[model samples]
Target chain A: MSAASLPAGEPRAIPTAFAIAEALRIAMASDPDVILMGEDVAGGGLRPEGTEEIGGIMSVTRGLVGQFPDRVLDTPISEMGILGAAVGAAVTGLRPVIELMFIDFLGTCLDPLLNQASKFRYMFGGKARVPLTVRTVTGAGLQAAAQHSQSLYWMTAGIPGLKTVIPSNAADAKGLLLAAIRCDDPVVFCEPKGILFVASDVPEGDYEVPIGRAKVVRRGSDVSLVGMGATVGMALAAAADLERDGVSAEVLDLRSLAPLDEDAILETLGRTGRLVVVDEATPRCSIASDVAALCVDRGFDLLNAPVRRVTAAMCPVPFTRVLEEAYMPSPARIVEAARALL
Target chain B: MTRPPTTEVLQVAYRTMRTIRSFEEALVALVTQGRLGGFLHTYVGQEAIAAAVCAHLGEHDHVASTHRGHGHCIAKGVDVRGMMAELFGRRTGTCGGRGGSMHIADLGKGMLGANGIVGAGIPLATGAALTAKLKRTGGVAVAFFGDGASNQGAFHESLNMAANWSLPAVYVCENNGWGEFTPTAFVVPVKDIAERARAYAMHALIADGMDFFDVYAQAGEAIARARGGAGPSLLECKTYRFLGHYVGDPLVYRAKHEADDWIRHRDPLRLFEARVTREGLLTESNLRAIDVDVAALVADAVARAQDAPFPDAGELLHGVFATSDAEGAR
Candidate 1:
């Protein structure tokens, strides 16, 4: 069923991140196994009281602390500690959703994700399960600078044990977060910072979008524009502009990055001879490059033209708004890149 | 004044120490001979810490070990034959031989793998303790790290979390005076790592790691407190490693006298022998019989490991995914 045919959507105009936080809260409320641990979750520990909210700077986890007082936790500014606790809790019985805060902070706490949690089940001879989700904010937008803004889902996707998922919209964010929390594998749920405040029609009832699935947002025949996270919005906008120009653009929203939907990607590419990848991440050795490589490796003969890429320049996400805007993938850039391939 | 351990506990501790010593020496020889192919961090000097701490633990209690973890593995009841086979890169081993010296794991006995990365095990132990707490299993999780790991950010973070949550965990830092080649004096400026626990409001204890009784007494108290929901504790065991950082280091960086003296005069195995024999808890003859039995076990493991076949080419991709059929087969 299409969006127009569906019944009236929920009245609440919730931001994507808040919707995801609500889903986690609902899961925590329903299941005692669900717990949340992150930095400054119960704020004002070190500082004077009444300074900030329970959750950290995002305020996405605002009321979770009061709702699930024992389960909702504020950890030290230690990603490793948070991730490790999640791993242990998962192995025993608790399903923990840990916020990494920023994907850039992975440098400090990657071992728990990579070495420990990732390898636990396999190393334990298939005896253990780490049903853990690490929620981190990503993408270069809002001028958060290099350290805060990075779409590092591609990096996590490269790791074997992790299931890296990047939700492009509010519904996907809520559904994917719920699915990731319930999955028996370690999932890196990256929330694009730009999309957090973006409003969307999310259902009221509990729903989950299966992991390792891609959504075909727009149907077309000319060229396929594959994108993830914030770039998906860019691709859709670019598709609208492309449609006016008589170029029917098929927009593929790659909801999950790790167990990449090679079938959906190849099928889209097969039907549409031209392909363009729009990723907010850096150009060289990125998701853009990876998707292009996959197309060449599998659907090489199907392509009518060389795969085009609209990605950030190979540099750090600058602090200035102009530079950050230049660094992020824009709808204009996606349109320009897709037109070139066409 | 420390009380003498029972005959059974003394035998077990002595067995653990003796097995660790022999296993490290054997692994060292194997590495030199090119039988084992990975980096080998031996638990030679820090035997008492593993022996005594594990004396209070059973299969229910869990432990997360560092790279220097053969002693911990044996003490925690991992099959010696499986560990040896894994070191030899045979598929019959624990972890299906995928984990070599640094990654040897036995989850059945609650020995979480020996981690290659320093301070990585601290948080894992904290997590295991959390799992135990949630399960209400009354099982304590122990983290055996080094003085080097004590300085890592994870070490501090995990200690605070464990203390705050009242997780049943005991953080043991085997202060062997060195981390890899760098001595603790160069890496850490503090007089004692245990003193940092006061910041987290956790009880802290320091013990002579070379003395089995010292480690045993302190570990017993801390473990007891954890089970009783008192909170987490930091137990810093002043220990030493007889061998170099890896198997082949010249060890010229360390003051020769310090290591030499510890090995010769302050050997935990020798000290334990003296104490147990002096107290008449066990005779020298009884210890000799156990040593002989252990030697045979170690020899058999090595022999079997030598004869064991390496995993086939097709087996490389296996175990990466826990398939439904495979999970059911187990």
Candidate 2:
């Protein structure tokens, strides 16, 4: 319910992926119990010269193995084993931050998250504690295609025991990842692949953006533009373009999905009677649909117009850059959706 | 012919086997009387494997169990009363009535719940061992799975990872001849499941699953190897399940004669009793006293379980997440 305080350290420009890597480095240095494991997380598995390989697919865990070689392990290409073992390690008192490579790979290893980590504390009657953090890449802008380019945070967010969070920028990526790693429950940390290379001013040193709290990045009184992950950037872009049309738009970034900041959503809707949800995921049963339903359920009286959602079409992400861009919910679509509501 | 176990260890093994037998028998009766709900898989004929393997473990050691996990739970020194209450769906159960027969878990005892999914516990145990290795806890993790699970991808992946990482883990496969309704031989081309461990470059051992001494000796070596940081090993115990897959199944897959043959000739309890008494490691009177004690213990557990009240409706929403207020909001 409380918002994470902004970091007090001097700000420096860094990529979101580098910010995540720094956060992991801080967590490992802070706590001996914190360990990192995933496929090629450390890289350089069989290199004869033993040079550092790709720190991670996106280099989010780069240079971590050099400092904490024992803690940061390179796992085989087995998502099930990696996740299941992470759950086991978490229950046994070690905090494990595992990489799922991509959110779509969740299909291969759903049992550990759905049946094991998510259900352990409940199924064991409050006797178990799974302090496991699953960090995975999501979003559809890279033309990585169907399997790799998917914003499937809603799946984990919908589960009962799991905590799902997506950071919209570099600062939030570092802070929220720290929070997720330190939190006592299982958290699905979704990093937007679209923003992996995007650079922004981020604070150095340790700080945590509390999970389940949304940040009102830009405030206005006419229409509310709500989004998360990469879509939040699109929402902001749309809000800026809407200013030319004499429309004052408020931008709200939902940092956490599972704890769905109902109060924030309602407060934003109360201030602005019009609402538009932008999500990179498919329309059906997605966060866009979820927020739209939330507005209709709790903030219906506050709305002056019907809530609208601008989401990607319900189809596999095409490989062509142009088609992929078209498939993704763009700022134009968000502007159109917001205009429709107004 | 490993050295005979001490008299005290033999008595402990006998009590474990006896407790498992009495517990499963009580469950069968409870299910037959329609008192217990959900699927019930009994570990009647494979008592020796759990008892002997668990005897080598301590409170610091971890074990992940299969669906037919009653024997594993008892062998690991889980509170029989709590397990029985869990089966009865009472608030006082191990999982506070959340986990039934298939999912009973007591983490305080280092038993990482009985999993419902096939081959799910392998990676869990491997991970526990990884934790131990990372933390330098010197604790070894054991996974008790069936012959059917060995064919699952999880089994291979877990074994390969454990071997690659040299994790402190031991995988024990109870080759009970059948995988649910189907014969394991029909599905698995291999004659011995342990032979598959060669792919991972790990040592594979076999034991008489029906003999307490054999299983104890083999499990001891494997568990010791894991604890000593010799990496992972697979121990396959040739055994049988006397009961059908679940309580309600008619068991039409196997001929009645085949079931009768395994039940009569290869019963683990019978083999243990005969061997211990003949070897003078344990007297017949000693085993009979254990049997009586176990029977009384099981009866008391059932009585207490039946009397325990069910969890209130409010409990339905609790315990999902450890720290989030969202669980309470839900």
Candidate 3:
């Protein structure tokens, strides 16, 4: 369903970050077992008499501690500690939604997610469940520099047990986050920093988007433009430009990366006979290459031409605005790739 | 000094220590015979630390262990037969043959897992304690790590958070003198790992790791404080490992005399037996009877583990996720 057609109580316009915060609030309110923990999640722990809380560096967890003060905890600047504790808490019956602040910091605390949470169920012979949600900001264009702006969901998605999802807009942020928090398995909810302030209609209360399902945001019968997170908006923009040039482009927003929707990719490939995979992540071993491989391996006959991928350069995300702009994939790049396929 | 433990507690402590010693000794034999595969970090000389500290924990309390964690597992009341089967890579094992010695776990018994990565369990235990505190379960979580793991970033981070949040966590550093092949002193400049606790404003306590009574007394205080919402503490147990870091190691790092001296003079099992017999707390006959029973139990576990079936091929992809369509695809 389109954003305009969502039910009435849904806010007409809400920032994507606030939408995620709303999801956290809803999750904590729904289950007493749900808790939130991250650095600055509750702002300055020992604030001055009348000073307000900072919520978080991005304000995604703002106004949460006010409602669930005890559950929304402010953790020390320790990604490893925060993630490891979340895994421990999940095993011991608390559903903890932890924020890693930035995806790049995953290097500091990846053992908990990679070794512990990902292997718990399998290693324990199905006896254990780690219902943990690790929320982090990803993608370039915010001038967050190399350390903070890189998209590393591909690394987590490469893992077998962990479920990785990225929302294209505000509504999916709420639904997918709620789904992730309630899911029995460990999930990595990636929020694109570029789209954090992009306003869109978001449902008010509780809702869920299935973990492995993809949504075709736009329908067409020519080249299928595949994108996720911030790139979905870019793909749609490129599709609009292509439409003006008498070319129709179908845009698919891949919500989940680990349990990839192969059926959707092949189905769109079957209809369009051409593909352009757009990703904000680097070129090698990314979702774009994955989709390109999927088409080559399974839907080889369906492709009228070789699938094209519009992805970021292999270099690290640069700090300067000019270089950062050059680092990320643009709508023009996506349109160029789509036209090349056409 | 704390009051002496009751006769029953003392007897149970002796039994656990004896069982750990017997189990590790049996593993040494198994490794020699090439019956067991993979890395084996035996807890032969350091049995008293795990046995004594685990005595204070119940089923509701949780503990995260280290790579050398069989002693902690047995002391925490995990099924010896299942643990043995796990070591042998059998379907009936605790992890269904998925996790060997370094990864055995029983959530029902509150043993989170025996981690393979150094210092990884510290945050896990800290988190579990946070869960207990937030849920008001009155449960405490203990992280049993080695001296080498004390140098890890996770160790500092977990302790800082535990202290900051007043989480019901107990950080137990099983200072087995050696971290792998190297002496802890070579890597760690500080005389006492517990001294690091002062940075976090946490209570720091040291214990004779070879003495079960000392460990029990110190651990009891820390666990009690945590359970009572007094925040976390660090209990550094000065102990030593009898064998090499793993089964196949050449162990050329330390002098043979160093190992011989510890084994002869400071063996935890020997110390326990001497103290209990001298104090008239337990008779020689009683200790021997318990030892006999433990030997039989260990033998039976070995027999069962040998006879247990390997996991079916169909079971390969199971248990990766609680629910996923990708199961068995690989």
Give a tens-digit lDDT track for model 2, residues B1-330: 244578888889989988998899988888888888888899999999999999889999999999999999999989999999999999999999999988998888999989999999999999899889988999999999999999888899899999998999999999999999999989998889999999999989999999888999999899889998899999999998898888878988889999899888888888888887787778899888888898999999999999999999966778777785445453
Error of 3 at B112 (Å): 0.7
The digit string of per-residue lDDT tens for model 3 on B119-236 reads 9999999989988998899899999999999999999998999998898999999998888778899999899999999989999999999999999999999998998889999999
DockQ of each: 0.45, 0.78, 0.78
TM-score of predicted structure 2, chain A: 0.96
Candidate 3: regions farther than 4 A off: A1-11, B325-330
In model 2, the Cα lDDT at residue B108 comes to 89
Output DockQ, candidate 1.
0.45
Angstrom error at residue A140, model 2:
0.9
- Whichever of 1 and 2 has more DockQ, that candidate is 2
lDDT per residue as tens, model 1, B168-268: 99999899988888878886768999989998999999999999999999999999899889989999999888888988888888888888898999999
For residue A195, what is the lDDT in candidate 2?
Answer: 88
Q: What's the candidate order when arranged by decreasing lDDT?
A: 3, 2, 1
Docking class of 1: acceptable
Q: List candidate 2 segments past 4 Å from native.
A: A1-9, A45-51, B1-3, B328-330
